[model samples]
Structures are given as C-alpha cells and as structure tokens.
Target: MFDGIKILNADADIQKLMYSSVLDWNSVVNDGTGEVVGRTAEYNNLTLTIKEETSLVKVTGSLHKYANAGIHNADDFTPERLAGVLDSIQKLGIGINSALNNLEFGVNIETPFPPAKLLERLICHQRREFTRHVSKGFEYYQCEHERQFVVKIYDKGRQFGLRSNLLRFEIKVLTMQVLHKKGIGIYTLSDLLNQKLYPKIGNLLIQCFNEILFDEPTIDTTNLSKKDSDLLINGRNHKFWRPFSESNFETKQKYDTARKMRYRQEKRFRQMIDSSPTAERLHKLAAELIATKWEILSNPIVPLLHYTLNVEMGQSIIPTAKECPITGIDISDQKGSSRYLSERTLKSDPELLKSLPVTIGQQRRRKHHHPEEYYVAHNIRNAASNPRNSIKRRIERAVKNTPLFQADEVIRLTDEQKKILQSVPSNVPRNKKPR
Candidate 1:
C-alpha cells in the first residue's frame, strides 16, 4: 500500500512551510475514521508515509493517505506551535554551525546540504500527513561504505538525546578511520578531540591530505643501495661496503704487522721485568734513560751545551774539604761509586751520598710554595692597609668633594625645614656677646 509515492521537488515556499510546522502522529490522526491506522516514521533516513483511508478525503493512490492526513492536521494545527518548533530547529542549526567552526575540518557550507534538506522535508511532510507521527517520532539515515544505516526514534521524548549521541559517534568514527589510514594512531576519543581543536594538528592533517592524496608522486626508494640501508639502520656494528683496491690490502697488512710487533715488544718487556732479580732497578734505569733521551731530543743543543759548560766551569767538580783535596776526590769517587752501586760497599760508604736529579713533582712543589706564600702575604698586607676603614674614607672623600649647598638640595627640603633654615639669625645679638 506504500508504493508509487513519488516525492516531487518541493517548491521553496512549501519546503519552508514543512520545516516550520510541528505536526505529530497523535495530533494528525482522527479516531472517527473506523480504527485509525498509525503511521510509521523512519528515523534513520528521515522518511515518513501514512496508510490510505476511505473517508471524507479519499486517498486511493500513494499521495492519497498523505494528502488526507495533511488536510486533517492542517485544519486543527495552530500557527503559534508551528512557529515555536521552527524556532527550535533554527536554534539547532545555529548550534551545529558554532560547533563546526571549532572543528579541524570545518563545515563546507553555511547550511545543511540537499541530502539533509530532503530528509528534513520528508520528516515535516510525514508529520503533517499523520496525526500521531510527531508524538510517535521519526528516523535519521546515514550512508556509509555504500550502505544505508538507520537510526529509529520511536519515542518523541528521546528524539533529541538519541540524535545527539548518534551524531557525535558518527563524526568521531569517521574522523578516526580517516586519520588512522593516514598513519595517525587515534589512541583515545580525546586524541580525536585534540586533533579537531589543536591548530597545529589541524594544519598538519590538511597538509598530509594535500600531499599524499593530491600532490605528485615523488618518493622513490627503489634504487636505495646497501649503504643507504646501513645508514637507515643507524647501527655502529653495521657492515659497511668497502671499495675493492690493491692499496686497501697493503694498508691492512701494514696495520696487522705493526700491531703484532707492538704486542711482542710489550710481552718481552713484561717478562723481563717479571723475571729479573734487579727488575725494579732495571725498570727505573730504563724509565730514566727514556725520559733523558726525550729531553735531549727535544732540546739537544741547549742541554748538551749546559752540561759541557758545567764540566768546563768545574762546578761541583772539586773534591769537598773533608775528602782528598789535591785529587778532587768527589768527582773521581762518584765515577768509581756509580760502577759499584749494585754492590754493598758503596751503600755502606759513610762519606758518599746518593746524587739524584730533582723530580718534576718536587720541583713544582718547591716553586709553588714561595709564590703561594707571597700571594697570601700580599693579600694580608692589602687587607691590613685598607681594612673596613676604606669605606669610611670613601664616604669622607665624597662628602668633602661634593658641594654642601645647592639649589636642587634646597628644593628637596620640606617647607617647614626650609623656613626654619631661612629664619636662622646670621649674626649673634650684641647682648649675647657679653657672655
């Protein structure tokens, strides 16, 4: 019975009238027509149709039942109620606009599209056709993935609540899927909200969509090499490609031989020091020889000349007053003692003293002490000479140097103080001089 109902392209005036009206099922139905049939409203697609009735207004075809209901409802419907309902819808539109303004992907139009308008028109047309349609409720439609999804509002009381929840859910799910496919992980509903509101994220989303979906194909990774792969891995142990060359082999062989020689020399030195009875003495002598050699190589001329000059000058070369004076026993004895230093005789000699060069540490310590003492004494002398009295001296010098009286200074004084200063007698009274 609900077939061949052709919905014509409604005129602007009719469309406006339908949206402005607030007709419902119970309000449109007339009980006098031998068991009135209740009209069902599809909430999802927002479509409504009424059953044909044999009455004063006969509706035989698809348009018959709707026409009958519309006539009946319009006869009793008040203009004030219709206006109030229209106002409510207008307010809802305003709210939706405000909400879209804050969205990352803002609404494309100032008003709802043709599809939305079609649904709205059908809703109002059904309401006017059936008496209890508004009281019974309506449906909303969602077209997703090439499939139709319906949301039925059976009870009028839940119309607003259900519609709001479904709308919010639909928006969230759509945005999540879109963002997720673009490599964005929507961990929570809050993430979607943030992306929708945050300006940076919103701009990034637009940029990503423009580049990946609309821009030219530019990324080419087909020709990537092994070196590129190693770089991408960012690993220290990664094997890098080395060019095949004769020089490479020669360089590797040289490095290996030098390393092997260094290892053998170190091992021999370690074994020698570990086995010898005078190992400590030999090691010390080696170290001293190396250090002396390094010094000689660094300044060969200066050190050699200095030593030669010392020998020529006979400094510390003559024998001490206690030793044989004529033979200069100190020099001859030192040479003889150096040869027998490993034996016990030289060690037991009461007159002979070991001669050793001062170490770097000892020289530094000797040089640092006098300079450190001098700095400490200098600071102490400065503190004693000035003391805290320097502050007083500075203040006294400033006071003496500055002009005691000035026009600006007089201006700064209080009126009473200034008057008192001006009234002070310049000369003492004659009577006061007698005292």
Candidate 2:
C-alpha cells in the first residue's frame, strides 16, 4: 500500500547507489557562481536530489512502482514485497531508521463500476470541497489544503491504462504528527517493516474515506413519506447541506449553534438511511468496500475469491489445515481450530507467529483473516431481513460470474449523469465561475 515516499538527510553512499541504479543524472549548478552544488537523477520511478556539500539528499518517488519494476501499482504491495524493498534501501546505506519526510499509503480497490462514477458522487470531505486537478496530463480528484494530510481518490485503471476498475483511495500524510494522533507509532521507515502497523494504517485510510460525504444521486425514495422523501432528496443536494457543516458565525455561541444543528442534520440523514429500505444497497456497497480493503491489508496474497468461497461454503470448503499463502507452511495448528491465522504471518518467521496473542478471547477478537468472508456471510445469512434485493448476494454472484481481470472502459457520461455531476455541491465546471 505504500506509495510516493519522500526521505530526507540520506547518506552520501546513496550517491553511489544512484550512480548504479538511476538514469539521466545531471549536475545542479549554482546559477551565479557556476559551481556544482548538487546532482539530480531519475530512475524508473525514483527521483534522487543530492547536495554534495552537506551530504544531504532528498529522495521522492513511488515506492510502489519500484516494487513492481516501474510498471504500475494496481497490484498489492504485500509485506514480503515491502521487506524486499527495505533490503534494497539498506544496501544503499540508508538505515531502516531513516525518517520519512512525507508518506502516502492507500489501496487500489477494484470497483464493480467505472471509478469516475464514484469520483463524481464525492461531494466534500470534512466540509472541504474536493478540487479537481490534472496531474501529468491525467485528471483526478482530491480534497486538500488541510494541514495534516490530503485525501485523494483517483482512477488508477485510467491512469495506467489497466484493464480493471482500479480506484485508488490514498491519504498523503503531510505531517507525521497526523499518524501519531491516529495512534500509529510509525516514526521511521523501519517501523513500517513490521506487519503489525498495517492494520493501524488501514484503519486510518478507512477513517479518511468515511469522513468524505458522498451524494448518492441514484438513491430510490419512492416508498418514503412526503417529509421523509423531501429530506432524503434535499439532503443529497450538496448546496443545501454545505452551510450546515461550515462555520461562518463570528461568535462562539453561534458557532456552537451551527455545530449542534449540523450534528442534528447529519443524525437525521443517517437515521433516514438506516431506517429506509432503499438505502440497503448503499450500506452493503460501503461494507463491501471497507471489508475488501481490510482483507487486503490483513493478507494480500490470498485471492478475493477465496473469501468468496469461505462466505458461500464456510469452513467445509477450506481444508481442515491451511498452509501459509506465501511459504505454504502449515499454520493451522498455530491458531488452534481456526483454519488460518488472522494476520497471515509466514511460518518461517516463528517470532511473528508467536507474537499473536493466542488466548481464546483475544483470538475471537482478532480481526478476521477474511473480513469480506464474514461480512458477506453475515449479510447473506440475514438476507431475508432486507426487503429489497440482497446487495451482498448480488455482488457475490457478480464476482463469481465475472472474469478475474477485464479491461476498464472510458467513461462517457450520459446527459442524466452530467446533470447529476453538475448538481454536486462545490464542484464547479471548468467553464463556469464560482458563485
């Protein structure tokens, strides 16, 4: 999940590594004195900026691309892959304790539809409007200008010309204190080398995603009472709801009033969705996205289909004893009756396996190794509770029927789609001026 990292105060030996590994090395000269101060070079996805006088170097590039041979980052950056990358850094005389200046971590989720639709539905994040930008000539959407971090949601499939609906949702942490605030004890690059920190990182990603307020234009409200329907429809209009979350008041009491009113509005909207039958699909879709992301963060090697089987067939489908997905070593005995370890650790690493708290209660409380499995299974078992179509069941069926990989098509929005996009709050069109 690690991508686009920046490291500062790199060692002088890094210059040697760059000489061997990097391409297009050029001298950065002092414009007035014509004396060379530093050198800049570009590798496939790694950029190196070196100041020879101070031995201070700055490295900024996509660690994901480096791991994938500079191809694309649509695939998972597994624990094993990260270890290998860390080893490469060590070889370059960069300590694992090297402090990162900036960090970006996110997963590429395979959506069922064009990611542009999801991007279009994004209204705002934490009362901040998402700005549209063209990066490297490719269009993407992001919510930025916050001091701590930026929330980015972009079409990975379109960006890399991949044949999948790869929607990349990532948090670019501008300040390391943000991670500390989130209870993620990651100070150095080596801290991330451990498998334990992944869950915390994944939690941060999900929290950022949840903070984004989405406008579901396709929600159905036909069965609702007049008042309920009006609320449902009007709540989705970004223009109508933006004022509630924004604090324009001069006095503290007035600000508190707006805060209380905003909370009430949000509660009402959430209550409506929870109580209404039409929102079942939206809830399931959200659950699926989060569950799938957690599953990948927990165990990237296992295929998504394996979870599908666990949901559909339960333990009867998986063998009584399961081997490590990476090394194929037996670990079923490690977790007692549970077929697999919750955080799939390599059998070769006994310390990692032993690190797991094996108490029955802790075991039960452990994050599911297959989060999507339990999620889908739970929803499938309770399918009859929902009057509308079972969103989980539909998703399962679709996944089962669809090919593992398929080409993502360019999105050509219909007139109706365009209208919905235009209605989204704060998303001013290129040709229009902000009111």
Which candidate achieves the best TM-score against the true structure?
Answer: 2
Cα lDDT of model 2 overall? Answer: 0.61
List TM-scores for all candidates, in order: 0.14, 0.67
Report lDDT per candidate: 0.26, 0.61
Clashes of each: 23, 0
Q: Model 2, which residues run further than 4 Å from truth? A: 11-15, 18-24, 220-250, 273-287, 300-335, 339-435
Worst 10 residues of 2 by lDDT: 308-317
Q: Write the residue-wise lDDT of candidate 2 on 302-413 in tens digits.
A: 4222321111113222321344322223565565433333333333455654543232123222555643333332332222122122333453455666656342232333
Model 1: how far is 24 from its true place, Å?
6.6
